[model samples]
Target: MNTTKLNPPTQKNRLITMILAMFLGIFGIDRFYLGKWKSGIAKGLTLGGLGIWWFIDGALLLMDAFLHSLGKDSGFVKDARGQDLRLGLSMYRLKDGRLQRDWFSS
Candidate 1:
């Protein structure tokens, strides 16, 4: 097994994902970027009208990002640069073979 560690996404990406999730979560765009293809599609099919549950989900995603940016561990997957990697999208590969998805690249 290739035990290669997976990196997180950049701050910019995280913000983008959060914004999309908040605004278009009803369409599952956020979920799609989060690697939750099934859920994303389901949300889209249902028009995200699954009652208050979908609203709560959006709130949680925003909170997660807020917590992470506060220097607090969000208990989520982070890229090599310690940035939270959303899902679906791949970060840049570092020279050391590690992945980085940060706003600033070396």
Candidate 2:
């Protein structure tokens, strides 16, 4: 059985990510800034999926930020390390092999 190791949330700046996505998302700058190099390259190669991906990413970030501001668990996007950008949900399999829900990250 494989276990998922949970790490604390990363301190990456959401605002900076938003700015990068807004201005240079076509180049995958936002993914690069989040340390997601593989997706970054893919995004770059696809030209942000002909701009659709770019727009979706921006919208997701906006939604994530909006939900976070409401003091809710809202982790629509995570960094390369598999940690949420903010307090959000996590999933894990317990030792007994049951799926467990970790409602928030610190």
Number of the top-ranking candidate, with TM-score as the measure: 2
lDDT of 1 at 49: 64
- Candidate topping lDDT: 2
Off by over 4 Å in 1: 1-12, 75-106
* lDDT of candidate 2 over 1-106, digit per residue (tens): 4344465345676667888999999999999999999999999999999999999999988777665555544368888876666432223313234444333323
Global Cα lDDT for candidate 2 = 0.73
Report the lDDT tens digits of candidate 1 across residue range 22-77: 78888877767767777778888887866354686667766665554443434353
Off by over 4 Å in 2: 1-10, 86-106
Clash count, predicted structure 1: 4
